[model samples]
Target: MMSSIKRLLIGRPLQSAELGEQKLNKTKALAILSSDALSSVAYGPEQILLVLITVGAAAFWYSIPIAAGVLILLTALILSYRQIIFAYPHGGGAYVVSKENLGVNSGLIAGGSLLVDYILTVAVSVSAGTDAITSAFPALHPYNVFIAIIFVVFLTILNLRGVTESASVLAYPVYLFVAALFLLIAVGLYKIATGQVPPVLHSPVGTPVAGISLFILLRAFASGSSALTGVEAISNAIPNFKHPAPNNAAKTLIAMGSLLAVLFSGIVYLAYYYSIIPNAEVTVVSQIAESVFGRNFMYFFIQGTTALILILAANTGYSAFPLLAVNLAKDKFIPRMFTIRGDRLGYSNGIIILGIASILLIIAFEGQTEHLIPLYAVGVFIPFTLSQTGMIVKWVREKPAGWIPKLMINATGAIISFIVTIMFFLTKFPQIWPVLIFLPIIIYMFHTIRKHYDAVGEQLRLTTCEPSFQIEGNVIIVPVAGMTHVVENSLKYAKSLSPNQILAVYVAFDREEEKRFKEKWKQWQPDVRLVTLHSHYRSIIQPLTKFVDTVEHKAREANYQVTVVIPQFIPKKGWHNILHNQSSLLIKTFLLYKRNVVITTVPYHLKK
Candidate 1:
């Protein structure tokens, strides 16, 4: 019944052969992969203005220059990643490039940073989307965290269906957001040209307690760089694209970068021209929309689309995080379970994990974009620096076609990214410090995982050794509760394993039950010898475990193997399990670590 429900909700399980059908074409891929970059326009400029507002209204003018800097960085990053697409077509993005070129430690750092960045992507995107909702309908403000978590869960279900499925579900909303923003830009520009612009209002401000400085502008730039967080996602998930994956991904990157630049620059320009100030009750974009559309239908349309796109942007992390985890698992840097694909061929483990992490962040920060905004860009720029620096090293070593120019571009990107990372960390210390502290710990975990895998491989490696078996045959022990069909089946199976050395042992806690069981056994004339032992303390596991230990010790002394076959009853209904004592579980747990003792459970399924 549960499987039917899951199949109904997520669709029927697809075979691996259908993976090709699941590959995304360009349009849908852009919608799913680029939503993060595109949706940042909803909050990126607002973040810049938020930092600028600290000094006074005069500092607001600095936003334009800061935005231009971000655009420049965005363009450089796009170009660098375009080269990365052609270079690492297999897709590990920075981690792959850094590991091959820079070193293992460099690769681990990039992987750790990207992992944290993906989690923060879901958190920040969902929080910002929730803020968009609350801005439109203030009465729902208190439930924003809950709303954000619901969105995460919804996206997880969509993604678990398959990448193409999620992309198709998300395409219309992303396109609507694009059209809404462009319409706002076009209409706002028309109003500005026709001298129909709404009157600019300056909310009363507090006296400047701290003067604005160069450090303030740098911090604002760092804050605005949130726009670039998901740009590398395309490079990381190139395999998800249709045939000519590299070319398609490159085209999508250029398209996404172009859209982001236009939308972000236009929004920043409109915000500055309209003298929009950051208000706690409403968003900068919402304020700009109201000034242009005067709280009409178009205003609400823009708000609705903003929220939809922002919520859907979490899909970018859903698409990329699992792919990243697959790569890590392939390298033995993490658990192998992450490498297993779901019924729909999606990385189910990674998707569920990303959802849980985002849910925690939303709850912890109460779904406030302002708080999550500060923690956003730090994880992003670390990988930016490492990946670009690794690319520079690649160029220096391989010196492929046009390596010099590529080398120069990546070097510049590396330098700029390194500075931005430092600034980002300093601007949001302690809160952002969790990621920094956990990075080294994650790297150590990777090493430990590798070490353990190595140790296991060494232990399991086979070497030729002469076999010694003075006591030629194996001993099979069947532990029975009574003369029931479960025991009969187990005894028959044990006889098949070793007909000459089979023993059925019963530990008796009640004398009357034992006498009745013996009487029935004698009447039935079972083919095997039955050993009955009385336990005065009434401990089933202790007596059974000690008996098995004694048998195994004798078998080992004679250089022979011992097998313990146990029968277990499986209830037809799950709830019926509680009515039984679970003696089989207790006995199995006790014998799990015993040497040379092979334990197997033969289940007797009960019919309702």
Candidate 2:
């Protein structure tokens, strides 16, 4: 049944022999790993401007310092994760890091944070993109949620189709976004230098730099930190690259860092130069484009590009969430279903789950980027701090003398990330506390589920002791339906249990068949006692319970223990339930409820 669904979703499965290793060259690997980082540039500037708008334009200049801090942190994080990729490149990711160093609960916390962050990445990025498009084409504003859903569905289908397919589709759009944004920056700068002095948008308050506070500056920093959210994707995906994993991962990391830094800095400078501000009314990017290009085709072009980039940011989640789920499945933290590959060899369940979650988020928040921004950065930073700290622990524990300088670098990175995480939690808690409240509930659920699985596993564990059935003269009642293979096999197995006696019992809804079976049993198996119970209501369970009670009473009178054995046929195909039956299970349940009766099942397997 599972195989049928897998085939339906992604066509034929690749045979074990046909499956080849992931052969990612440096360029392709960089594109795949850097997608999340590169996509962040789309919203990083807008987020910074979003916070500044709350306190008026005076706070806008503080974006420069915030951007600078983020850049430094980004560099430190990249360098630190580079060590992670080299040291533990087999792809446990942040969860593995925390587990090996900090412990399982720490890993669970990190995993929870990463899971929430990945979902937000998709929702926030897609919504931001939709806003950009709506800014460019005002008609789209009313249909923003609809547009975001369509984009998410499209991304989900592409991901379900396979990773290479998704990469091929996303690579061009991401590259186009980078190129267009760079061109806009270069031309806008040229306009400024040539005394063209592209008109800055009129500030709602008349002049810039009015009514700002330190609290506001911190708020803007928290919002702007959304750009750094995707930088950890490389660490998660290192194992997917070509051989010599460390070298490939390092190169990918360097490329991602460089691209993010350039794109992020350029966007920040442009947003600041244009005096973009927060409004209960208009979008910052749209107003800025209108000011720079002055109500012309150039204005439309900039708005359109910004919108596309925002929508494409969801592609980052399309790529990362499934990988995170797959990692979790490997650790037994999530359901094993996520560990299974689809026909295309991608984690289809994870992709679909991610898509649905993002869609729900889009609806719940009404596709508003500002609302989702607060809940976004906290999770990513928490995992970032924990993973980096875990890496520091790893470095100290291993203590390779030659790598002391690298260890110090990683230690510094961990400290910086930890501080940032605390700052984000303290300042953004009003907006973020809800997530903190909700995440533990989810973590606890996973923990409970894991405990249940472990308990069941212990119960089912095989032992070397010889099989022993202590019958204490228990009356063994074997339910027989007719001359089926299951019934015959069950009787033979029951005889092996060496019970004191066996009663062949039959409960029949059809009087004619019951009469015929009674006559036949009298002639054929006279040595065996036969008990036939009558059913007035034509209910199988009631009739069976009546017969088992009589048997238990007889066993008590005879000073024998009552034991019931039912023949059950286990189906090979999971979906044969509609055709085959489940009467044996009903009988076993009824028999077990009677006093002094022990019910056992002797399963007979159908031919494959």
The best candidate by lDDT is 1
Candidate 2's displacement at residue 432, Å, is 1.1
Count of steric clashes across candidates, in order: 0, 12
- The true-versus-predicted C-alpha distance at residue 434 of model 1, in Å, is 0.3
For each candidate in turn, give its C-alpha RMSD to the true structure in angstroms.
2.9, 5.6
Q: Count residue pairs with overlapping backbones in model 2.
A: 12
> lDDT value for candidate 1?
0.88
TM-score of each: 0.94, 0.78
Regions of candidate 2 where Cα sits further than 4 Å from its true position: 1-9, 21-23, 198-211, 279-282, 293-309, 402-404, 463-608
> Ten residues in a row with the worst lDDT in model 2?
198-207
Model 1 clash pairs? none
- The lDDT per prediction is 0.88, 0.75
Off by over 4 Å in 1: 198-210, 463-471, 509-538
